[model samples]
Target chain A: MNEPILQVNDLHYYYNDNQAALNGISVSIYPGERIAVIGSNGAGKSTFFLNINGVLSPEHGEIFYHGTKITKKSLPELRKNIGIVFQDADNQIIASSVKAEISFGPMNLKLPREEVSRRVNMAMEYMNITEYGDRPPHYLSGGEKKRVAIADIIAMEPDVIIFDEPTAALDPLNAVMLEEVLEKLSAEQKTLLISTHDVDFAYRWAERVLVFCDGQIIADGTPLSVFQNDEVVKKASLTRPVMLDVYEELVRNGLLADAGVYPRDMREFRELIGK
Target chain B: MSHEHTARSHTGRHHHHKGGHRHDTGGSSIDFYACHSRIRHWNPGFRVGFSIILLLFCILANHPAVSCVIILTAAWITVGMGGLSFRRYFSVLTIPITFILLGSAAVAVDFSRQPIGDFHLYLFWGYLYLTYESLLNTLFLILKVFGAVSAMFIMTLSTPSHELFSVLRKARCPSLIVELMHMIYRYIFILMEVQRNMRISAESRLGFGDFKTSCYSFGQIASNLFIIALKKANAYYDAMEARCYDGTFAFLEEEHQANPKHLIAAGIYLTALMSFWLAIR
Candidate 1:
């Protein structure tokens, strides 16, 4: 197997209140992987992301990017390659104008002015926010702000992008748009890790699933294998995706012949049902 | 809305003192108008410099006639050239005008046990008096204040905060100060929305039914907002760190070419104001 792009081992982080945000987490994130992290609120998904990105140093354990262990001296380099799209777009956006906000990351990289401007324009185009380039981001709708927030990091051209609840405040249409963007990002071979409560979206979008519960990884595998484990799902307080429930019920009641592998999404389900 | 516009939050801790230019505390209305202003494409540096110079001219030429011209011309430039409606122009002026009236009252009205000036009124407690010279002085002060403020309004109501910050950047202002202004400007709206939502929820629960309850709710909201602001600041730092921020900020300024016509118009206006000031004196 190709080397993992990011590796976290025995990571433990504690909040100021002495609450264990991440007890002990060890994970290998390969390049070009679409991973969904699903858990209840306060399951330490955000803390885990922050730790890996070096925003919050873990009390124990180490993180490695491209086989080089992250340390104080290497933090800047690590952060340059790992971008976290925070859940609150308002908190993430630090610039007044959308164009300037997008330029922030690239500028911080000390890139040439022409390179920064090119990345800013490209990121704005990628997020379909070229028209809002000059508009104040505060006036934008929640979803539009989310796109600009994503563009802020996209301009940095990070190798790995972690979105913490990207669809929380997005409308249905905007949520679909986010998914399309995720598809495009994944196609470009950028590693993507999304933490979401939407089990259906995770089932459809992520090839690999990581179940986080109380700061520990309860399960990690393909979405089909992870969701099929009743023990882990029940422990993590996760619900089965609606489509999977229907498929399982049909097979249990002998309405359809059991297939060795369940379909991953609607298109596959339709093919199985001969629609 | 008025309260939110004027209410200072913890984020205002940054010392953002621009020379003679009062930081806009009038909420999003001015910003919205400025963002959509027809003349928003004009160079912000020229706008800032022109307004500051005009403001100084108004102050030094403290004559009422000169002030009147400043007020009328500024109103014309803001409303006519900037495309802001006359109604909005006056609506935004209302806050400063209120301050002017209250301030002028101190200088215009006085109490005495007996009449001692050109204008006097007998009252049960005392005789109110207004000397002719004092009245004229009060009038001069009011007009001077109004003219200075209106000149500032032309700049603020026509240029968005981003442009103003960029102008500051170009004027050799420290990047740290400009970056702080950028962060503060962006978060002000967020904090205001949070405050507005909390107030609405408080009102729905009869939190403002009485003076006592209103005070209590206000305290609760203020404290909660402080806590939220601190949390937000920490999260914002995390976000900035993720972007590889290394104690330096490089803001992207929109390129706007300086138009000589604007300079010529400014020159003609200032020259006319100076001649008017000389003649009126």
Candidate 2:
């Protein structure tokens, strides 16, 4: 296939005096891949994202983005290629107005004023938040704020978008909206990497799953395969999606012949039951 | 309710000093300080106009009668229309009212000249004079102070802090100041929690042994708290950078349009204020 867009080789990281947070992890992500990194708290999921984005330097590893080593000298270019959406919308939001916030990233790249305005308009329209253009960040609802946060990065038009727990505090409806946004981004040929504990979100949105445990990549494969392994799930402190759990329970009770009968959506679930 | 209002009046003044302008009472256990969240439903332009009027009234009206009228009207509006109870209103008013009383007393004692023939009471080396002009001036000053204060109270009570920020943004307030206000608003609670935790830890360790020991321990605690706060601030900044923030806040909602009704009301208020000023002149 084509060269990987991002390659991590034997990455190691730590905090507070050599207490390893990421231990010799290696992963390569191809272009336009929707990947989910699942792990419990303190499992180094956040640290890995930090390293990839060049926010934190790794202890003994090389990270390559577009064939260039991710170093301080190359950070500006690396950051331009990869956009990160933080978990806390409050902390990430820095502009006084929505329009300004969305325009900030592109403006920082020294894009022409007209280009910056066009990108801001397009990003806001894509996110369905055109009306909030003049409103202050503080007045937004939690979901709206999250959308703004995403829109901020989207305006930059990065090659890869990394979200750290995008759905952590979002309600079900907002979470679904965010998932749709992610799907759209992936469809647009932008690689999407999300670090989350949201099993259902990962199951539905991720094409490939990377399971992290105690700062190590314990499992990496398709979501279905990674999630099916009981040991990996247990080690990562994650639960299977509700449907998977139900299907497994049904098979255990001899209600179904096999556990491989997975439904992709609610409609499929209903169809599988002939409802 | 009156007692609560009185308490609020007192605490409100103290809060002004404490830099607690953005009263976030949703998760706060302090019932008296609970800000009304319903104000979010009001038309943004109307709220902005109302805020401007309140600010003007506070700055311009100095007479006690006008101030009394302002305070009473605000109280009535908050209680009758805003669905706020007298208790809630009083809780906000208590501290300010105390300050007004204290201020009036001080003015009377320090500045008012005693009428030669009319002495109210004689004390050791002092005579208490009761002058009609002095009393009227003192009362008027007290009323004006309360009036101005109550105007601010009504604005805060009727408008949520977030909405205020939105209005400020729309008004084209300095972006840096607005962002700083927002950050300070959010971090104040975090700092309070940190301070509270630090105090508890210090207490648990029995750091308050004696005068000198307590002072030294307090200094150490303060230093440690500052360092911790700085570290958290740095982490928060890193988190922001990781999220691709390049400075600028975005909102989810559209620009709030000014309502015709609010516009009309604002016009009327402005006309009335000008007329009142003319009458005073």
Using TM-score as the measure, the top candidate is 1
lDDT of candidate 1 over A1-275, digit per residue (tens) = 99999999999999965788998999999999999999999999999999998899999998999999999999998899999999988888888889888999998999988999999999999999999988887667777889999999899999999999998978789898999999999999999999999999999899999999999999999988988899999999999998889899999999889876687788889899994
Candidate 2 Cα errors over 4 Å, as ranges: A94-145, A228-266, A269-275, B1-98, B110-119, B122-125, B139-179, B189-232, B243-281
The alpha-carbon deviation from the true structure for residue B140 of candidate 1, after best TM-score superposition, in angstroms, is: 3.5
Compute the DockQ of candidate 2: 0.18
- Per-residue lDDT tens digits for candidate 1, residues B51-99, read 9998999998878988898899899999999998777688789989999
Q: How far is candidate 1 from the true structure (C-alpha RMSD, Å)?
A: 5.6
Tens-place lDDT per residue, model 2, B97-179, is 87789778866653223435243565656566656777777877777777777767656666644556767877899978877
How far in Å is the alpha carbon of B68 misplaced in model 2?
9.8
**Residue pairs whose backbone atoms clash in candidate 1:** none
Clashes of each: 0, 27
Off by over 4 Å in 1: A16-19, B1-25, B110-114, B123-126, B279-281
| DockQ of prediction 1 | 0.55
